[model samples]
Target: MVGKCPSCGEWNTYVEEIVRKEPSNRRAMGGLETPKAKPLSLSEIEPGEEERIDMHDEELNRVLGGGLVPGSLVLIGGEPGIGKSTLVLQTVLRMPERKILYISGEESARQLKLRADRLGQISNDCLIVCETSLEQIYVHIKNTNPDLVIIDSIQTISTESLESSPGSVAQVRECSAAILRFAKETHTPVLLIGHINKEGSIAGPKVLEHIVDTVLQFEGDQHYMYRILRSIKNRFGSTAELGIYEMRQDGLRQVSNPSELLLNQDHEGMSGVAIASAIEGVRPFLIETQALVSSAVYGNPQRSATGFDIRRMNMLLAVLEKRVGFKLAQKDVFLNIAGG
Candidate 1:
């Protein structure tokens, strides 16, 4: 027998790491029934997956690995104003036929409506809730029984049982855990929107990511009209899937061909422009990488990047010197994603 750990209420904490010394073959215990039933036959088993959650975008569906799988929990995180909520709202809105419930903590129904109106086309079947309490949210969910549920920013939601303030580490972790359990038990696919820290990771305890079946990071610069959704964890599909979108007045439009958007169209054979193939999910993409190596006038060599990694830039520069004999230690290397 197993029990919950009193310290953390986690089940199976006292696992039997080592076998106990029992009397030799003490009549191996069996089930209460006389015999277990036979497994289901192949004919009895059902075929054909349930209808995919259609978002009306071929690229989005492709990145989702043939559409949204039922009972899947997806966590979407992004920087503030990076279009995470807008992208999800657009996705749900584009699916005019699918039953969707949009739970917003950062915005009101009227605000969402205004944005939806700006987007031009939206489904009337999409439900909206602006509450933060998990119990209340569950109550509404039961009443609505939506095919898709969007929680706008998970950190803003709080559970009544949690004494900590909303957005706190405790509350974020607890609310997400409860939602994950509810999603799995009810077989309802949930899309959780989350905020990102200044450090460019999903804000909140790392445990929150582990609780969900998929972790998607929405990234892009505010100045640029482009946004990227990169999967960090995916239990239902490949994690390397990446979805690119171009923010416009009508809504976030999917980039059918990302290479055309990410590469510099007017290169003119730029000295720093370099295109490389990157493997994201099950697909390989050719992305333009621009690196600028300038003499560092400031006392501290400042490193700036648009969509590339700063640490990786430093490492690459070091390699260029150590391997290729290009002494760029005192130079400032600025890297960017080139175009949209």
Candidate 2:
């Protein structure tokens, strides 16, 4: 259970063995670097037009840059109970007969199946596993060789090489790095779900974001029923792509037009309410901006914002009254996004 470190070259730095996975009959195919390979043709190495999957949802397809790319690493992150797992589970289930391996460190197969059943009839090719160790998941992936792989939440998976806890900075970083290496070497597309901290950022190390090919953050206010999928980093597709969805009793329905979902038209022509178009990735959407100006009853004024950047709004208001020649410097201002 020992191997030399690739970086430090320290003998026995890696524990080659850990909580072992169940055996499988699948074997890795030799890569292009095989010794017996024939001379390559110009067209052999030339890539054809990218092919994509059609999951019957335009918003999801748009976020995935027309569709899921083969051998791509996609990281999905979100706040708790925000339907990160639900969206992916439903998508994989509804996919058109593609072999898929799903591993959940937090839930068992029976539990996932119960939810899948409630989601209606799913494809038979999707398989489920409840595992915590990265090595164990790798074995299942190698054996199944599924078209798609989904890790429910990467923060729960661990690698034995690091002695730290599973969700710690070091473990998250190392585990993600190992998974990335395996996916690239094997040319198997993998989807990793992640937990976000209270600060609205991914819980693990920042480097975890750098390791993955695509980073998708699922964002929505707990009080609101609309959700947004934003691609922060994407090597295979446009980084500016945005996906919109609405939470209904059945499941998440794609919102082709987000303007209706993000704006509240009940209060027409309300003061201090402005609609602005914000661009994420390569797509642009309309979001309502709400502001309230109240007299400073006491000597000290309070500046508060919900869902919007407080500091930036403060700076903007200051610029408005000072440089832009607006009045009322003594008023207190409150700002918030309609549905964040």
Candidate 3:
């Protein structure tokens, strides 16, 4: 094992692996003949809008900066139970005209079927396959010839080309590269669901984010029913877009106006409660903020904040004392975002 990665400059990140090279024809991009280079000036290139496929879900489409682009690679990463699979499956099931191939490396066929039944959307063009091997996945893709492809959790996929285990840095890097080639060659859009590490970044090599055309992050507290989808990187659209969803018994439902759900009208005259307006991307919404100030029981006044930054809370308290002539030195201050 290498002490550090030469490319990424991370310590102890390398793993020894045996690479089995295949024939030229078996490779995704190896069989093509060499072509002469052609240079074009800025004026020579044609400018046109990219063709996008409507996901039929407004919240999802807005986060994607309009719609899904054909032949693009989109990577969605989130916590394990963040409803990544449910969101993708629901979107594909809504489109009955498009031929979609849903490849699950983590869940079984029966499990997906049960979830689909709960979603209550049926599409005859959607194909489900439980596969983990990269070679077998490609074989199925070739035979099916789908317009769109969805891979549920990329960490579970492994390739025979490498000796390393699945989810390894080398394996993820190689497998994603091969899949990207296939998507571009066939002009088919591919959606990859990924797991986030403890640090909240997508699991596997950092290059996985760099390789994809778009990188979306699914975020929300599991306890809370609301879910947020944010676009971190987009090659064909703006990155400052976000989508919100509400988790229900049936499935995830789109939340167009999140402010209405976050605000509590019943707490209008309640003390220590205030309504604050916040904007995410281009959308503005109101959020409820709760503040409690009580006399300190101990020698030191305790300062605590949840869903809101404690440091910011402290700064606010200092402003109140100095600017507003409020003596809060011996008080225990607590702040919280009510709907988190």
Candidate 4:
């Protein structure tokens, strides 16, 4: 049995699996043509503005610079049941003009249909296929010639070039590279969904993030209805861009003006409550901050914070005790962000 993993430094994480090698002499399936190469001077190349397709969703478009860039590979990652697929499906379903091909490796066609019905009308001519073999996926892509491509989760796709199982480090890396080459060569925009590990990073090799053109992280507490989409890496847009959405029974609803829902008017005159303004992307909104101070029951004082940095809270407390001459050292302080 393996004791420790040299790659991730995790212990007792190895599992037993059988791998069958495939022949390398088989015909290529990814439709990647070897183009003739030639060297050119910097002045020989022409420059022009990149053409971007409008995503139709304001929040989504803002996070992706202005719109979706052609031939770009975008990867969206989140926890289980965090609405990664739902968000993408809803967005693509709204675009009727674009011929979209959605390839699902984790769910069946009927299962996806059920979710789509709940989401709303399918405006686009979207084709759904359930497949895991990377080679066969290219065959479907060649026949469909879709304007946009969607891969539900890259980890579920396995390439014949590697003998390792799907979701393995080797498989994820190779599959992503193949998809990247296809997107660049075909000038097709691809939206990829990925799962995050327990450590809150994308599962599989770190090279997966580097391979994509853009990386977005969907985060929020499952118990809460609010979800935040943050851009961790963007080759076309600013990384500081953020998108906020509210989960609903039908689907995700965009929050254009979040200040209205975030402020609790009922807590008007309550002590230890205050309102603050914050900006995410280009939208500015107001939020509520609540603080509670009480005498410590035990000899040691307890400091806790939710939706805010605890270390910053401690530093603030120290500032109050020293500069403001407030005796808060022996008291308990609890801070929370409203509607977080």
Best by TM-score: 4
- The TM-score values for the models, in the order shown, are 0.73, 0.76, 0.87, 0.89
Residue range 253-320, candidate 3, lDDT tens digits: 89888887777778866899988787877889899888899999999999999888888888988999
- Please give the lDDT score for candidate 2: 0.81
Misplaced by over 4 Å in model 1 are 1-51, 268-278, 282-284, 289-337
Pairs that collide, model 1: 240-280, 240-281, 241-281
lDDT of 2 by residue, 1-340 (tens): 4477879989876754568776331222212221233789887897776677676677777877888877678999999989998899999888767888999999888888888877775778998889998777767775787888999889999876669988999988888887776667667788999999889998889999899988999998778898889888877678677888899777888887777766887868578888889877665778998888989888877788988788998888888988878765677888878766
In model 3, which regions exceed 4 Å deviation? 1-26, 29-44
| Number of the top lDDT candidate | 4
User: Backbone clashes in each candidate structure, one number apiece?
Assistant: 3, 2, 0, 0
Which stretch of 10 consecutive residues in model 4 shows the poorest summed lDDT?
A: 23-32
Q: Residue-wise lDDT of candidate 4 within 28-86, one digit each (tens)?
A: 54664534348999899888878999888988998999899999999999999999999
Model 3 sits at a Cα RMSD from the real structure of 9.6
Query: In candidate 3, which residue pairs get closer than 3 Å at backbone N, Cα or C atoms, i.e. clash?
Result: none
lDDT of 3 at 299: 100
CA lDDT of each prediction against the hidden true structure: 0.79, 0.81, 0.88, 0.90
